[model samples]
Target: MRPTVLLFDIDGTLVTTGGAGRRSMEAAFEKLHGRRDACDSFPMSGMTDRAIVRKAMHIIGVEDSAAAIDAVIDAYVAHLAEEVHKVDDQRYLVFPGMREAVKEARSRSGFAVGLGTGNVREGARVKLERVSIYDQFDFGGFGCDNEDRTELIRCGAKAGAAKLGVPVEECRVVVIGDTPKDVHAAQGVGAECIGVGTGTFSVQALLDAGATVAFPDFSHPQALEILLGGR
Candidate 1:
């Protein structure tokens, strides 16, 4: 059966942010909170931006406030621009076969593509546009709205179902991502999870997380074909 909606994670799934996210968080701490090492060793993989910022603030013993959060976000955006500029030949890379996969999925009838990521809406757009795939997604769930990854997946699934004029139960939702969190989120919503071992996690690790299928990478044409067919 054709999936009614395909929900994808941004980092480590479709593209690499070229370490922009880490640099941006570090800069945000330094510029807005007067802390230089707030994000020195924070584990950001598969985490929401809001969660990252909140954790950083907690580590620095700062009281959370809306104004402070907004300031940090602003600093992160500015820092992202600067960091992206300095990486001369090391810009973000769209994963191999991603273009073809997206093209084929989007071209199919009853198939709608959307994002289920830990990035905020604007950040998601920035990352996707950098890799020239922003236009492929019809809608997305943003980390700025909620820190829970499962909730974001639900939000994404709902949005995609809305776009397709289908009930959430009737929609064949597939979540494609790179981490255990992604698998957990997909399972939380009763969606199929496709884990790609393009990030820190190994294929076995993702399989342990209950991914429906785990692949080391989808760069191979045959693997890509199998993945597409399975979806």
Candidate 2:
């Protein structure tokens, strides 16, 4: 088997936190900016927390400075952890076959799993721990890694390659996600993208966004083959 690294996305791809993330983010903005709906119109798919904060600040007519953005990130992480615990059990959903996919990947040879998510580090941990699948990913690139989604994905791929004892250029890197942004980001870095429609977007939407492949969920009969075959 060739050296292969799979970078997975949290939230919509691996698990769904319902609106817990939004609520938490909103609370943070309200506390930091006195604007309860600062991020209401922000597009969140495949975006980094840093980007989100910056966008939200712009929308709310606040100064978008490095200092302000960092503050928002820090506050959002704290609020997100608190809100995750308060989320209803039913609201925290793990997509069907995703856990199986993750387990299967871990069991397979030449495969290293890591995260490429828009969420901040602590927020990612809390969200996954809420769904009890946090242990599957030991390393990842969070929104804090960079404001650019593509860069964050590359960061994850590099880290994954490091864990696999190979350079990223020598490995077949694939990004598995649930939104068009994921596909677009993969395209930016010339990597393969498998778009799952477990999020707000549909399969067609992802395909339109230039995903090489799109699926409704990981429960398809040939899901395992399709997922692993990206390499």
Candidate 3:
């Protein structure tokens, strides 16, 4: 097989934070700006941590400078450390077949597996550690890398290719995520995306968004083959 890079998205793709992320961000915004509802009802699916904070700042009428956004994210991470544990075990879940699929991919030669997520490094760590899956990925293109999902995906693809000492263009990159944004990001970087309907979006929705393929979850019979770029 040719060298391949597999980038996985964290929330909604591999696991569900069970509202811990939203709660933490809301708490952080309230702690800094005195408005708990600043983030209420905001469409946050697939948005970066920094971007979420930035939007909350705007909703609360606060100035959203880089330093300001950083402050909110810092506080959010602190709250997340506690929130991840607070959520009931049933609420926080690693979707079925995801861990096994990741293991299978990593065990293969010439396959570089890592994260392509919207969470910042610390946030990803806190959430993933709750389920003991944080160490599975050694590198990723995090929200800290770029606020734009496409740019971050590109960054992840580049990093994954570098792990095999190959130029990004020479390696086949596949993104596994659960949102239209994830699909769009993969397309933005000239990579393929395998969309999972583990999140708010349905498989058909992801397909409409232009995913190379879509499945209800990692448990689909043809998932591994499709993910590995086989028919």
Candidate 4:
């Protein structure tokens, strides 16, 4: 088997933050700009924290710049740290079999596991640590890396490959995520996506979005095969 690096998305794939992320974002925006509902109108699923801040800023007639967006994200992470404690493994659902699947991938000779998530790195850490899955991932491509989903995925894959001592171009990268944007992101870099319908979209919707395979949840019987690109 060729060396494959797998990157999992955080929010809806590995574990649901159960609104802690949203509440944190809302709180941050309110504190920073005095706009209590700054993030209310944006389409958030699969979007990066920087993307969210940019969009929200645009909606509120604020200038969108690297420095300004960065400030918001910095604030967002701080607020997230506070709000994340509200979510625990008992309250947040870890998709069935995900932990074991990641373990299985780690044990395989030609595989490496990491994260490619839209959450900012710190926010992702907070959310995953609460769910007890943070230790499983050592490197990640995060919203802090890039606001663009496609670029972030590539960034993540490269990082994962580097950590495994493999060349990025030679690595067969598979992104496991739960949104159409995740599938589209993989397409942007010519990688395959294993889409799980643990988010807003259904399985068929994920397939329609160009995922190599789509499963209703991580519990699906052929999940391992699908994750490994065997199907």
Q: Which candidate number would show the highest TM-score if scored against the true structure? A: 3
TM-score of each: 0.93, 0.95, 0.98, 0.96
RMSD of 2: 1.4
* Candidate 2: tens digits of C-alpha lDDT, residues 85-169: 7767787889988999999999988889889888878888888988888889968878888888899988988998999999989
Please list the C-alpha lDDT of all candidates, in the order they appear: 0.83, 0.85, 0.91, 0.87
- The residue pairs found clashing in candidate 4 are none
lDDT string for model 1 (52-156, tens) is: 888889899997787777778778877776676555445678887788888888888788888999988888877777767899998987797678999998999
- Write one digit per residue (lDDT tens) for candidate 4, span 43-139: 6889998888888998898889888888888888888887777766576878888998998888887787899999988888888888788999878
Q: Which stretches of candidate 2 lie over 4 Å from their true place?
A: none
In model 1, what lDDT does residue 50 have?
81
Encode model 3's per-residue lDDT on 1-231: one tens digit a residue. 779999999989999989999899889888988888988867889898888888878877889999999998999999999999999989999998898998988888899999999999999999999999888886789999999999999999899988989999899999999999999999999999999999999999999999999999999999988877689
Which 10 successive residues of model 1 have the least lDDT summed?
222-231
Model 1 lDDT, residue 34, Cα: 86
Model with the higher lDDT, candidate 3 or 4: 3
